[model samples]
Target: MMSKKLWEGSKQFKEHSHLHDYKLWLATSKGLKFKNYQELWQWSVTEVEDFWESMWNYFNVISHKPYSKVLSSHQMPDCKWFEGATINYAEHLFRKAKDNETAIIFGNEAGINQDISWLELKTKVASLATYFKSIGVTKGDRVVAFLPNIPEATIAFLAVNSIGAIWSSTSPDFGSESVVDRFAQIEPKVLIAVDGYQYNGKPYDKSNIVNAIVDALPTLKKVLVLPYLNTNALDNFPKHYENINHIFNTVSGELTFEPVAFNHPIWVLYSSGTTGLPKAIVHSHGGILLEHLKYMAFHNDVHEGERFFWFSTTGWMMWNFVQAAFLMGASIVLYDGSPTYPNFNALWKFSEDVKIAHFGTSAPYLVACMKKGLMPKAEFDLYSIRSISSTGAPLPPEAFDYVYANIKDDVWLCSMAGGTDVCTAFVGGVPEYAVHSGEIQCRALGVSLYAYDDHGNPVEDQLGEMVIDKPMPSMPIYFWNDTDNKRYKASYFEHYPGKWRHGDFIRINSKTNGLVIYGRSDATLNRHGIRIGTSEIYRAVNKIKAVEDSLIVNLELEEGKHYMPLFVKMKNSAKLTDEVKSQINNQLKKEYSPRHVPDEIIQVDDIPYTISGKKMEAPIKKILLGMSLEKSINFDSMRNPESVQFFIEFATQI
Candidate 1:
């Protein structure tokens, strides 16, 4: 069935974790005793208010004012955490910086860039924040950035947060319109952007895209551009633009912090825009601050001054999450280019060179390494890697085997599953536990997650909907521009009526007491380990006159393989030619990225729809995965009853 013990924590490993220290403090200070992790976890979720308050006290959260209440309401869509508390998230990042030898390590695909010291980082952040204030950027004002995974992105984010202004960002690779769709909704006052970026050893010049994006956002007051690729990047712009270098050149002002409420919005992270537009999900400063502290120290088991790196772009949530390593006083590593530039050994080589302690990446990257059969342990010296974390997709059991056998024998592999909806991991690793194959070590403390069946009943040891019965602090404050919290409630609470339905299929094995996530339960496209919405794809596909209608689905097969096929309905018996396919692929790439291009294009009679006139993507996804036709579709609820049979026959052939 499964291989024996992938990895186990030694006695030293258990004692070295933050969990050990916290438990000791609990017993000494609060007189709380627990036999094992489950007992501790039980106390965490059961007594939610007391548990979170302990986290606040244990971590010693520096607040401008004391909280009147730990939690105002326990219900979803209304939980006001740490109400009446005033705190600044950026204040904590500097607590470990006084011993500042180095705060951040920067690297590119080819080699290491410059290492930024904590003093330098503080200076730049102060300078930028001063510049922002001079330009009228105030608290709660949105400042958006279009950049890559670089030191500037981190600096800008910290600067924005330090001044109590809101922050939002996406990768520079996004098409101009796609960027507009998300940023326009927020009505950001300032635009921070890069001219271009390098990926897979090739340079992408986005000077025109930046100009186009700026043109679309009428609310933008001032545009500051980074000459990342060409020095004359701003020369081509139609209007005058401020050089981003001005702030760096000037000596910074006195670094200051603005005290805001605990529930004040820190940053806006985007969803896949699956329905219409990308949901601008907002996370509070204190919520993320608390969550990140717990996750980085306890779950990841990272010590201060250790080098932490996760391969991520500015667009992804992990990029934001990676910054939390600062809360642990860890040196965060930012690598800008493709993970597999010269070869698959690119990131691995960088890890060895940088001596990264916490190596964070996606499951797909690990699977690729397994397929290539590249022995990283043999090829490079990865002795500094204390732990490895994978997210954005499920890590197959075989990939777990590969890590122990081929990468590092004793290294801890923490395969966690969470989304942009929550900036922190819902279920992740516990340093005190054994590393079981294909199982997340534990559900995060203070998160009440359970596998629920369709009838809203919690089920054990069976695949069911991932639901959270208790409110987490890191849950969204509200969607940007959402009126009366309507969209926010519908996105999460509508499914189960008060309980958050996370749209992920998961099962908790009774034997291991660990979680096994089966990927998203909905129609969101899981390509390249990132969730993409169908609306973005359909927007590009619709431009083709030959295609009248279309539907796209991502099928998660065995061996960590993903099959995404786009079924197109031709217009008026029009032919589906090679030219049409090329047009579709190019448009998607131009609009989004290469990941948006589907693997296969097949002609279909029509696309399926529900009785409410919404695209019936979830049912088609189940049918193509070989579920029985009767279970996959109900004729009474669909707009077209007979359209689904073609997919049923087609599934057998594939």
Candidate 2:
């Protein structure tokens, strides 16, 4: 049975909502009348062209050239949106900046507190842009960063986008090899990094990692290192490093916007790379500008001068989403440390101290707090917080109740599901919509998301593949290096041909029209909302001379409950020992990330594979979750057909 609505908007909230503003504008201009969010959504999906054009025009997108057509083609991977339109992504963001208004508010576990005004932010971005131009960096050049979630990272991203240079970033927490694996593919011209960052109240110096990455990337012509922790960090690094402070101090100028086509690449994001190398998914300037404007202004209800904060590392896509706050002239709140450092109340305290209006985090964080019995409502004064957003995983029904009963009764708790692919949520928060317990309010406007059965039949109120029938502005322009579009088509289009299979198991409530995400249908581990590829784990384990082969699977035991155990096929000469386990753990932490390290390590005689010698990660994942063996895998297709019995028996023991 489905849960009841947990929270509803007040009369004041409804009348003043950005959604209401959009409705009024549409009704006055387009003569579109919608009584509710459902009616509006119906019109949005059915009249796709009008809905997107309305969104584009409603945001008053500052395009230098008008689009010839809304969508040139409707085919997936071949969809060309906003054709002939020329725009710069950073232009819209800077246009909203105010001289006296605060642009950024930052705090960290180390008790660092600082704020950057809009004027200072613009000046910093301008300075960085000038420096990049001096070094021959121009449009379409890749500028990558390995930095913490600091103001400088945001500035660097803004400056890169201002000059029409594509930007990509990863958290400093990523292992050196993992960082290299991602940045090397893009062949960046300039690399921005930090000396160190604080997490869990401990300072971690990243000079060694930065040095190694710089050495690995021969394509880098310049390296700018920020002295985040150590002021003399640049002197310690063994490279021709330029101090970020020197560039800011020496360079001063106004930013010059570089206009490009609507489909011009703005940023290059990466896939989980479970099967192979991470696919460099590229997104365009115009598409992202329009999508974010709609998402922030309408869906998130972010108003000018309001404070918006989302707990994210540079590695996650949320960091990119947070930048849109600037486009709306809202102050962005950034924290560069563990949420639970010193105590679990740290995040709530930060919110209270900064007076955040919109606070966002992952489902696991809320579940951890609930389990630990840390009641923020009873302890902290979160008076200014209006909305709390949850993503990365499904929010348990219990979690929804806990948020209202223990956190804030009046606040809206929005649980959404979208991923790195779109850089936006497919189903997310709608300020005017009633939030049902454990369900996303509604599908995002301009997104045609629905569940489909294996035979391509659409289903509601039942689990199936979460498929998007129509393309949105934010879908990846293309996978970098995918010239023939073979890899891109196989990734999404192969499942349904025309529709995009997002590879998530989900269901939409027939009555409430809210979404419930079960988990990933693929082998990627989405633990703590971070997507870690299975092959990344294999890369670390394979390096161990004693290990023969390995299989890693993340099983969703229940909502917000997961068990990721590493199964190993060890060499006959090498036995499973404490030392070997420690080595594997250390290597995984060192090479991939701490998130990918398994909760348990178990020895197996053999690892299952297909006749084509491909690792059967999806089948093994299903077997461990107690799914029927016959339905999970075909015996004739497996090279080691008898090997399936081992996991089937093991599932029963667990």
Candidate 3:
């Protein structure tokens, strides 16, 4: 049973008057019938076929060709969903009427507010589609975007999807090598980018990097610049490059769209190649549409006309997830600058201004806000916010408490966890579930997620691997350039046959019926034959007020023995005094075992992170072992790549 006090205090557990009105209809709805989450989960697995079929009908999935069958069988890997169904992904999203209802809200650190209503967004998308069609872009063609989270980027994405063209994007912050590494594999015919971008009150010109990428990728036929900063020289195009206006001028008014099969590829998302070259994970139109709608409507409790905001770039999968809100006719709020630009409460102020219903961000952003002593409860009237969802990393228990105490006591704190491998989440929150301190509420409705021991058997109350036992709608259709699915299989299925090993070390607490994410299984440290998670060490070390962030890794000694070594990154105002180091050691020894204590605690300036703001552990490990850093994937925005060299020197000397 859930704690009564916890249940009553959580906004998720409170009665939703909207759901109450739809309860009777939901109970008797054509494809949906469930009294509780458990019933839906059980029916989804036991009667898997009927469950998804019903979900499709309930969401009013617009398919040109009706599905011959809902599912093929109960097989984990081979199960097929909505076989023979034909649907246009864009058709479902443009369901909103041509009215003045706000569809997109764009903001930045420079105090820019650009709002696009449903009718205006439609017009822009149609104009862009006309442009693409004029340029001979037809069905199955690919268009690449290296742009920010501006309105133009969203318009480009919608236009490509509308005309059945595949869309792929990465943020402008990525270096030329990283951008080329990804777009080269896709062989995109058209490239869309901005002249420059602004972050933290500084402008960055992309002419050099963009020109390099455009020249290297021979398949790129055209370059369309959005003109963010550089706009004086009009005709600045290479031999094969053409400006966006030049292409738009030749666009005809006539638009032709082709509907495709349900499994047709819509977008290609790249995995964070911390270890190697990033893998291009492709997602289908129909599956992504259906699954995102389910997540937005039921899981997020998003209603039509509600305002939704997620602080993410086009590179992250959350950007795609946020764009899906338009399918429900909800207005999306977008920001394209540093969250702490000018002030720490930039996002909070935007939320208050937009009256956002659902606010999504990263764990580091919240932790930074906490460290800055930001209290939204005192300054902003964020009553409109019903849910706050966090991803990119596991939410610390203290962060959860900080949000409830300082942001809104009654708001739902959702710690959603999934990756680019699957466009949607495996474990997330539901509107009716009770929010725990540090637990993702439940497995996604139709997603089969469980903790498995080394023997591949399900386990509880202990740390183990998190695996999805069955395939869901949003599983990647295929990998780019992987002709025989070899790369796809090796990426996800090599660890366990026919099962997705999600690479998370999680412990399910039987007492509270919650989950505690220890850390990544690949990054798990082993000393004296005992496996330990990096988060255990982090949780103890970060508790010290002097430490801002830290990275823990296993260092192999000369005798081939392994010991835990931690690298601490202190704040600008703090120092790594001997007293603080001793305190860290004492805390670790008291909270955990002596083995959990680090052999050395060295302070650094900044921890290296990926473009999506995740700590780059594998690369640091490679650096310590004196290996090549070239193979370290996604090194575009490493905070301090040179610091790895110093770490290696220090390790050798020690």
Candidate 4:
């Protein structure tokens, strides 16, 4: 099956793809016919309501108030989508606002690249939705931010979803106790923050963590701020402050669009959970506008004046999945510091000075640029990179032969995985398949993904539990104050009742039909009875170039004792020696077995991630199984809460 294809797509380049003009508009509108892309993803998940009413009539969706049907209750926590749709996810990203095009392209760590236009992004989102309706704000209210991937955080999240409010954000390097444990569970009412942030070249002012998240958000009522890195930051705020550049130069008006109600609440996105208080989730505004117009026209083909770029952080979910490259009129490129600041070829020279064309990142930043053997195609001009993707984790297949041997043998590496519970990707990249090395090149179109087995059936290439049986128009329409749905039915339908397990650990590769994942099935790694998958010990410790990062876990003691361990994090003065623990136990006993090595190898000066970089493996296996480190993690949602005090002092010597 995997005849090692690495790149493919040609029937005259898949007939100038947009998924081949959406399979010739579903064969001249629904006469249908699909002899590939797995029969158009099995008729898009077995006719999920005539494939979401033909994706609201092949994306001409401008419904001011239409959807009265097209799925109501098909299962999982009582499904309901498109019920009386009133649309307006920021009027479909300014529905073709083409004034001087280039809508957003920033950059930071003071490398500088700026640009904004679409008539200065629709006049700064109509002067921040006329200063959020002159301070009273409205429709669903909330609002949030502490902001960073700038263009004033996508012009204040398209002016707080163009007035039907409710947005959320975090990244001012979090910590005001993780931005008041997720904007004090969404009781926001406008905060917009940021008088800080520089990173890797250091600045970090955060006016006392924005004056302690404006004195721990007492249902805020306007705060604004934004003098990025202190210009006497409105002389230090907190008495109901203001200034966000004087309300974007004196609040102009008329950028209206509040049609809402297609499952309203537009953003919230949290859940990098290492300990409680994070799952605010939410997502709607027509389930992320039909899942970002079907994930940017079928798993990111994202064309129209394309520029894209996704080295995210306005607290990750790929910055709301790179604003789905403004739903295909593309452009989006933001940066805001540290993609290895002034090093690791700063985002391949910011994707060769911004001719990006769908770059997106993370899979441990392509395994730390393939363990620093960095070539990035001999330093730049990546031929306007068409596709490079790689989502949060589980990529390791030698970072897919280091991107076709040093970052670009005609790119297209993808390697995706979905998270933030469906902010997109349920398996990724589908320009009509064939980019094999580490898999994941399909399964997205209407994602009814499988790989179940542990008795929940649906198997395929073994290693299971990554369910999802249908229901996805970007999943979460709940979570904010999660009550009656009881933490959204224990976060993903209590295991397998109606499906959607999604705590990772996938497989389904039947030789490149694609999808491999292998990570978080709640940090699984049984050992002697075999269960593994910490990306199979990070693809055998990312083939040990003096292992610069690693984590592994296991634990499960008593009567069938397991333990495991590993840890690593070496590089610089590279000492983990004993010949690097016998070359990491003979590369996990020659690539997987010897029960995939371990039972303690330790070195650790780093590891514990999650400020969206993830890999805090179920909070370090709930702190080496004795739990309690404030009940296993959440040191302000940690990026390195001091690399978690050497795993809480090696969890009290095991």
* C-alpha lDDT of all candidate models, in order: 0.86, 0.85, 0.79, 0.82
Off by over 4 Å in 1: 1-3, 523-654
| Root-mean-square deviation per candidate | 10.6, 10.6, 2.5, 22.5
- The candidate maximizing TM-score is 3
lDDT: worst 10-residue window of model 3: 1-10
* Model 2 per-residue lDDT tens digits across residues 47-145: 988999998888888888988999877777787998989999999998887888899999998777899999898899999999999999999999999
Question: Which residue segments of model 2 deviate by more than 4 Å?
Answer: 523-654
| Candidate that would win on lDDT | 1
lDDT of 1 by residue, 1-654 (tens): 233568889898898889999999999999999988889999999999999999999999999899999998888888899988999999998778853588989999867678999888898998999999998999999999999999999999999999999999988767776688889999999999999988778889998888889889999999999888888887876556888887689747878989899999999998754334678999999999999998898899888879999998888899999999999988999998878888889988998888999999987678668766789999999999989999876676777888999999989999997789998889999987888887888998988999997678999877778999999999999998899999999989998888898988887877667888865678778797676766557657866767877888999988999999999988786889999999999999997899999999998888886432346687788788888766666554444657877898889976
Question: How do the residues 438-543 of candidate 3 rate in per-residue lDDT, one tens digit apiece?
Answer: 6777776777778888888888877889988777888888898987888888877889888888899887665554566778888888777777877778777767
Distance from true position, residue 497, model 4, in Å?
Answer: 46
**List of clashing residue pairs for candidate 1:** none
Q: Which pairs clash in the backbone of model 2?
A: none
TM-score attained by model 2 = 0.82
Candidate 2: 10-residue stretch with minimal lDDT: 608-617
- Model 2: per-residue Cα lDDT at residue 239: 57
